[model samples]
Target: MSEAMKILFVEDEEALGMVVSDSLRSRGFEVDYHTDGESALQAALENRYDVLVLDVMLPKMDGFSMAREYRKSNRSTPIIFLTARSQTEDVVEGFELGGNDYLKKPFSMEELIVRVKSLAGCALNQENSELEECFVGKYKFSIQKQMLELNGKVKSLTHREAQVLHMLFEKRNQVLERKQVLDQLWGDDSFFNARSMDVFITRLRKYLRDDPSIQIVNIRGIGYKLML
Candidate 1:
């Protein structure tokens, strides 16, 4: 049998944490649950996990800070932020801090499970792929490393960014429906998730700005086309 996928889960609420962790464990995931961000960060740094589920509010450290610090050394492991805040800014900030997905509080267990499996699947696919590199215009994208290289200068990408870019490249010069991308990565197309997708699209445009030949065009009410 395959080893159970490991997860580092941080949530301060005792009841909620127990429920979520138990649910994940029941679904065949091996989860390391922590009640505070400080200890969670330590666990995350010292161990390898398939994915991270973090609550934004916690004692000693916030999820955003933990994710930022974790990204300094590790960029490939996927992070999903859990928070009560549904504001667009909070969602965007989570993504900016290197989180691959964001789940608001009061979320269903089914949704959380779907998101976790989606992210874990993506990470596993990248790790197990044989092709290491691909090109986008003049830029070189490293699949396993999660990096974009151009002219000797390299820019690291968060898991979501790399995933978005990979999807765009796969359908290069073709319109990739916004809902399609959202469903694949986030497991839902809620308003907050749509806003988060917008933020990622803008970031991708900036990252690929060095090559004028590449453009991620917005279809206005439809979707985006990565014109190369």
Candidate 2:
């Protein structure tokens, strides 16, 4: 048999942790279980796991803290957060912390197993990946070529446009704050640069108006959202 995928699971609840560990191991995963966030963070730093299954409520350190530390050291490892917290803010916070997926409380072992397997599979697929070119509505973004094509026509993007579009496409549908966008694209958030960004946004909107499903929504004082 091929080698099992390595997984690190952090859960403070003993019973739930045992159940999850058993379920994962039964399906050919090499599982390491931890009940505390500090220990889990240490293990994650010392060892490389294909995926991390973390619980939001953990002793010593919480899953969010562990995730933040893990991101500091590792960005490629896919993290699936297993938590009972189902509030909108909690879910948004999980995503903001770079969580690949979230599983709510009182989940089935079967569903959990499926999620773990699917996310792990995606992680593995991304390991030996080529540059992925994706579409934002009608605009085709070719990361490899650094070009954007709409319909049959292609518009060569300026350097700043390409960079901003890259960030927007990466977080498609997610609101990107104006300051964040400005900083990410230009490394500055001055008034002039902000106004320049708005101009680019308007240009991009016109270019993509061919597609009715794609829109760029302004969030007032906040950033913009590329709705796909």
Candidate 3:
């Protein structure tokens, strides 16, 4: 068998932590569990983990703050935030802090497993590793460089923006649901995230404005479809 993936899990709740840690281990993940954010952050910085599962409410520091600090030195490890709070702003804050996924409390082990597996698969996709360039309309996008080139002019994209555009291009000519985009990118489909997605969509529209052949259409109440 292949070596098990390492995971750093931080949760303040004793019972929940035990259950989740055990469950993940049973699924072949090697988990290092911590009960506070300060220690968790230290552990994360000291070791390399394939994924980080963090709870928003914790002692010393919260998950949001821990994630922000961790992102300063490490930008590649995927983070999943677990919280009881379902507020839109909280969800937005998690994403803004560099979290890759979010899970609300009272969640089932099955759902958590699915999310973990999906994230792992996305992170390890060989296609993304092999493919460096994608074409949309008259523009050329360099996946490795995170840049868009049109008519000899190049534009840089933020990490989140590049991720969003990458997904849209992957699903070109197909309707990509709003919730799907939110879940894949921000980890939740909260109202605030939906609004934030709109802003990204608008920015992408401006970037592709020079090419009339490319269009990102909003399917009112549904999602968006990128035409090229």
Best by lDDT: 1
Please give the distance, in angstroms, between residue 10's alpha carbon in candidate 2 and its true position after superposition: 0.7
List residue ranges in candidate 1 displaced over 4 A: 123-132
Which digits, one per residue and each the tens of the lDDT, describe model 1 over residues 1-228? Answer: 188989999999999899989998998989999999999999999999989999999999999999999999987788999988888888889888888888878999898887887777653266666667999999999976789999999999877788888888888999999999887787668898898888889989999999999999999988899998
Better of 1 and 3 by TM-score: 1
Model 1 worst lDDT window (10 residues)? 121-130
Candidate 3 segments exceeding 4 Å error: 123-132, 135-163, 172-175, 179-219, 225-228
Candidate 3 to native Cα RMSD, angstroms: 4.7
- The reply for model 2, stretches above 4 Å from the true place, is 123-228
lDDT of 2 at 178: 88
In candidate 1, position 115 carries an lDDT of 82
